[model samples]
Target: MSLVEAEIKPRKSLFVLKTAKTLFGELDALVADQPANSTAARAIVLAHMRETLVAARADAEAELLATSKGIRCAQNLCNAEDEIISAIHLFATKRVYPVDNPSEAETLAVSAVGGYGRGTLAPGSDIDLLFILPYKQTPWGEQVTEYILYMLWDLGQKVGHAVRSVDECLRMARSDMTVRTATLEARFLTGDKTLFDQMVMRFETEIMAKTGPEFIAAKMAERDERHKMMGNTRYVVEPNIKDGKGGLRDLNTLYWIGKYFYQLKTSQQLVGKGVLSAREYRQFQRAEEFLWAVRCNLHFLTGRAEEKLTFDLQPEMAERLGYAKRVGMLGVERFMKRYFLVAKDVGDLTRIFCTSLEFNHAKDMDLVGRVFAPFRRGKVKIKGDADFVIDSGRLNIAKPDVFTKNPVNLIKMFLVAGREELLFHPDAIKQITRSLRLIDSKLRNDPKANNYFLSILTAPQSVERMLRQMNESGVLGKFVPEFGKIVALMQFNMYHHYTVDEHLIRAVGVMAEIANGGLRKELPLTHELLPQAQ
Candidate 1:
């Protein structure tokens, strides 16, 4: 019953799922008391976890019906619930099922569909799971189905348990192992009885006879597709989805999309590594458990179909997570349209996100810091030929065409991806403060000395301009009141050849670059700090 549970990372944003209403207290107990050296132990633990998630999903449906935000999240909560019940049965039943050396059919991964597939869950919640039945491999007369059933009953504890015969949950039943493996998307919640039924009834028999060990191998294909869809956006076009100003809709979309995919991959990774076993119940259960906090909000907004959703969104910090699609184009597209109005600019993200005004002047400085954040933090680097850059007003910028296919905002994309210094540091505010302090000291000794252009601009002045740009560009809305008045102070000044206010404006722009890791590549101020930067 946590207020909100989400996976928030510098690159990933927020991922909050609503799949943990079922296993609330049960999963916590099992993790602490995990039994030793028993296959059934995996199954037992997973079952309780799955239950917690499903129960929570039921609550979310009730709330989603109440608000506009609820409508978006609730759109899929039902499908998620259906998938939850199906997966619970599949995973929990395995705990007591006495199938000898079941070859561990990756239960936890499949069941993870209950939670990760749907949303982020509460901590201590079990992961959801799903299992592809090996029905066609052996004849009905060759194995003891009774033993498997008995084991499931004994270990399941009547909580969250379910299993979809491979033949029942999919479409175009693929038993070549390779095909079957690549088809499962942890982000989507589904129990395709159509395909699952076929797999159990006939597909496995056809493929097993001629399948090669390598043919059935699906380990790498999943990553490749995910990389294409969730990580890279070389050719993705911006989706025309507009959020109509100030709702922070784009941020929310980004978080969900990234969380949606990470939950899928991470769950599979956990199962493959033996940290989790899918044949047991907690598979989908755990996934749901992880989503409790996220759903607490969705349930309130969506209106639960089953239970009461009594959580608030703001104080809990639920929607701010910004997780959705690994922060890739899929998520970024939504964020752009939701917050900004695209315009032509030489900025990193301008093609799809920004206004003619923001692009022409300060260049949506606040957003530039956020978009290039991954490169700034050293989490990743966006590479391009040096020839792709051009200079605008003494500032080195990226070629407009080069960013045509990228989701990274255009204006600052160059410094963010180039051989720039680290700006994505989470402590950007502190560093900016320290750097400005250094410039302030230097100015005291000799006014004619080199001015640290990046450090001099304080908030309210330069920062205020960027905030106004976000609203004008249709990017993000302005909320922090303290930040509002700060934007109000200066009319003009003398030390700056440009208006004193103009000087502060430039200072803020430079500060943003330094914070975003673009200062060194674009500014001469970092000449002394370069060696220690990269």
Candidate 2:
């Protein structure tokens, strides 16, 4: 079994349905005298099931609050949901609409999709389900599916459901990326095992076969769109934990790409697949755990699926997560600071993962080069320097120890990328991150190194982008210690939309945009002044 399946597989010891048999027996007795199709009888049965399951969910949630175990809480919630859904399926087929000697067309395979399919559920999260029919739907199949959905709706459970045949699923997935992504995480819950197995076999062989590169490109485009929608930065004060840039969705995108290419069972397997190093995997795990904890708490606190970490709830969330006041910082401020740092780590992991894909030839380097072609005027000729090389239109260190030999190379690399209008190779960024300790006060104050840093800051092409790369790789902060202090600093004011360092970078980006005529219509005065000042 996959790690996710195992994590959410209801433990017999802590099973939510410990008293399910007795409850079902009582339900059977209650409906014994009434007709199976009787509306009054069905109401009673549904009510009984709803009451019982609601209490079980409450108990599970209370345990979660007491233990403060976020991942386990999600698992147990999913397990509880599974028990409820499975019980409803049985009840619907046997009692509500019994079919004698059902035909092949009547076979239905139920599966969980989306985040629910990953075997994690926060309080009030929608339970996304997919019902797979053998071929065309039969009367009995439709009746069973509707009955199950109605029962869940009556229980106040939000459900996102779809009924499709194997062929229909494949067709829709082929035409729709959202559908394809949803089906990628589908896990069979209950129903016709043979039918489910057949669907999985065909999906892997037909739909997913040789489509890894396309899927990766599509996901990257989707991610870029999402980031743009969410302020195009990870330092938003009231961040959306699920959909914001560097949020849970970003992490899931990494997992999805890895899984699509390698059929990874767990995210840990990404390390083995060379998609992530061991240390980076740990960073991934930590960020995931912290984000999940925050999301779960958000839901519990709001009594709904609230995702944004708004100011009103920040203090309480911080307190609940054990964040305490420090001498100069409030607990909420500290909590938010940690959250932004984790988001930054996620951004790092994304770069590392993409680089791995390029290095492994899983991603098309030519496509990547084309994506960044708009920023290039023409590649500037490189002076005599063996320390750097251009690979697939990105700047890369020629040797692993280039930075160790001269810490000043850290500053020079970004300067070169800016002048040439290129981004850093993932390996180059990794090397810079590892070699941060070598950047000391002497190097920071060196004439050549300072000159390189200034050149990067004032570069006519992609100045903002280069500075962000440097900032993300730890080079900007190391070379300027004052900037390091504000890397993740929260302003704790309603007016400030981003962290201190992010605000500074964004201000620079705005100036660059004005200078380049990108924002001339909106800021003509700034555009006029930018060239003059330079």
Candidate 3:
């Protein structure tokens, strides 16, 4: 079974519902003795539930620390919160504001949205809820929502909520991409199932139908803007596990796309839909599990919803995750290396997913191609190579065995891409990755292969992008074994902001920018002497 499919044996200590029920029963007895609706009675209930929440969270954290099962901990915590909210809903309706015969407008359906709707809760993560009503707001509906919100707030939960009728939800989702995305993940938690089901039907027929392209474009743009804001790289020493490139947000983006376009309920469904192979799905699961584990550790260590893997928390996070000191690497260093490698895997999976979207015509080809397209100065002649073909202005292998037939094609592929100013088709990249074992010592030492590598490195056109692609695709590392060792190596120090391989690649990119006059104004001296050295 895949990691995601493995059942998590529930730990009784982490189950908050049992503890919550006992406390609620005690609070009910106390409230019965007090005057109805008295401030003192309300205080008694709030205090008891507050204590329940605190103890439940503490117990869950303790269990997580002991078992190191972060994914299960997240699910358990979410389940606990579900029980608490359900209990609140019952108390508000049955005890506080009893309605013998309710009108349709009085009905309310509570649904979890966003990350909460996805059935995971990191420590300190926001609890997002959507309250759906059958029609315009009734006094009872308002009262119920206000009561639930205030109760959750009093218990020290960070709750984000919206109360909307079904029509309002459809209208708002039509105008707002964020609302639409959240609604896509909406999972009914408690309340009128009929109302929630109606909203889902309308959302599918009225909003989601024939709008896959628009939603995909907006999401891709949003992701690009976020990546630009988050330093535009996944290799930063201190990375944001939630929003950084190749972080949880990237994984979430893939899931969002799959869900929006294909109506996939879970990422595993993507495999059955042929968007991802079984192996790729395994990669997805492993990366998701590791990233969540790290994010959970960060939240526990800081006692808040901390997302960044900062240096100060690195040691404790390493120790908590069971990383140990090795011959030359600290536990923290080892931990970070694993983090970067996982991040890279995320990037690869993203490329594969996006390419699948492109093939399905769900994603814009121009936008995807522009990401890896180098600056085009002038038209260049195309070299005749039967094994290669240009498709949609991107380089692609003519056959699957192009690389296996001749391992040197791995190095030559980059050369052709650099020379032609084209991006490798995602399938070609996938093929190259699968054929890395073909890059033996003989192929590495071959003069023709070395010459192709040298040509790519010294090319007058920007070599930075091609070299980076080679590194990411595993060609540079396998062909040049020295670079392989440092692929994700982290230097334990404050001065370095990136892993050794990333830092070196960035340095080369900077020099290329200076040589190409892209940064001449910023570094005139270096630009002036760049040619003199040549």
Candidate 4:
């Protein structure tokens, strides 16, 4: 009973149906006298299909211009792609299989998997497809799949496809996590629904049930590795919005985790269970919608599926997104800033979602959980009359107004974390985050709090790590308001290798290394002058 239950199927869409029918009638009239399976007949059908696809794309773009809702436009594009693929499947099946009556209960299943399967087609993105057989792959299935792929290629679509039996699919899903993840979002486009259903049933009952934790671990590791690969930072001059640390993939990861863990149909279901509040869900929707709009505009601008928001396109995209130059900032700067803000929202949502999963599903420390525990838990110590107590390496904040009551405690908690080389538990982090605003002008200039912050920053152990944790927890920005402006701030020139915030953090890390004599060989001059520098 979720709001989003079905794929954005073009066959079910009246606009697509009307468009396809009109084009098909023209194709039929042109090939009326030719043999059904003749080369000329096939060419006619292909041409008509291509023409219909082009027209549909134009309509979708027009819709985007009219409404500015990229989701709707993406769905429209998916629907058009579906209609084209479905038509091709039917056309080729008759020639190859020669069934007088084609019933979905009897043969192969043509499914759209991955991004395509999710029914959000970015312009010029690859059409990932699957041809599912009830049993083993046969000659007929092979021929049909080949014909469809070739025709799609002829129409200039970049296609990635696989032909697999139900058994092969299950085996692949079990063996390869990427394959499994892609298969999880597979949607039926044209062919045997029964076959697709059988695959879905077996995947859910047999594959998905036992593999949730394993899959989660693998996916989290994969995300960590990806973040490392993508500079281990969310802010970049030119970021890949689809795969960067806090990009669309992060958002998609949360949804995937929810779907696997809860067997939920739609993300809307997560709201009902308090996994995300109504406000958070609205933020989620806005971030997704904005990212999609930017992505769609990028595709249209570059005439391909261009995900990276390069410097050159920033101004154009900003203007297109209705942003104009302000007094000091250019249109492009404002646009990039907005993009980073969306990415930050994505980061916030990711933290909220992963925290929910940790409390709800992580009953015991699995291997992957242990690997990522640093991102969630902290050192255990119960001392003083603190409102919160640490039990079993987890910080439990017993009082909600702990920080509000004593603002200096903000720097104290981070000091304790830094001195002990412990991470801030999510609960502790959450409390601190909620009370960040309390560190106002007076508190920032507070002698005691400032001394505590400086001591933590200069701490011998894990100084850089603590600083980053402080920044991520929003403490650094609150303490030094000017620092907030440079966060995720990209320098347009090539001389600066990292974003402003990243460069600053790296500077601190390098200083920490030099202070500890860890960079003696790299900086002998600094090492010799270490005492004077100190």
Pick the TM-score winner: 3
> All candidates' lDDT scores?
0.32, 0.80, 0.82, 0.76
Error of 1 at 381 (Å): 26
- The local lDDT score (0 to 100) that residue 403 gets in candidate 2 is 90
The per-residue C-alpha lDDT of model 3 at residue 486 equals 92
Give the local distance difference test score of model 3.
0.82
What TM-score against the true fold does each predicted structure earn? 0.26, 0.89, 0.93, 0.89
Candidate 1, residue 496: CA error in Å? 42
Query: Where does model 2 exceed 4 Å of error?
Result: 1-26, 29-36, 362-381, 460-462, 511-534
Candidate order (lDDT)? 3, 2, 4, 1
Instruction: List the candidate 1 regions with Cα displacement exceeding 4 Å.
Output: 1-110, 118-131, 135-295, 298-534
RMSD of 4: 3.8
Predict model 4's lDDT versus the native.
0.76
lDDT of 3 at 446: 90
lDDT of 3 by residue, 242-286 (tens): 999999989888888888788876678999998788888888888
For model 1, the local distance difference test gives 0.32
Candidate 1 TM-score, C-alpha based: 0.26
Candidate numbers sorted by TM-score from highest down: 3, 4, 2, 1
Model 3 regions lying over 4 Å from their true place: 1-16, 19-27, 362-382
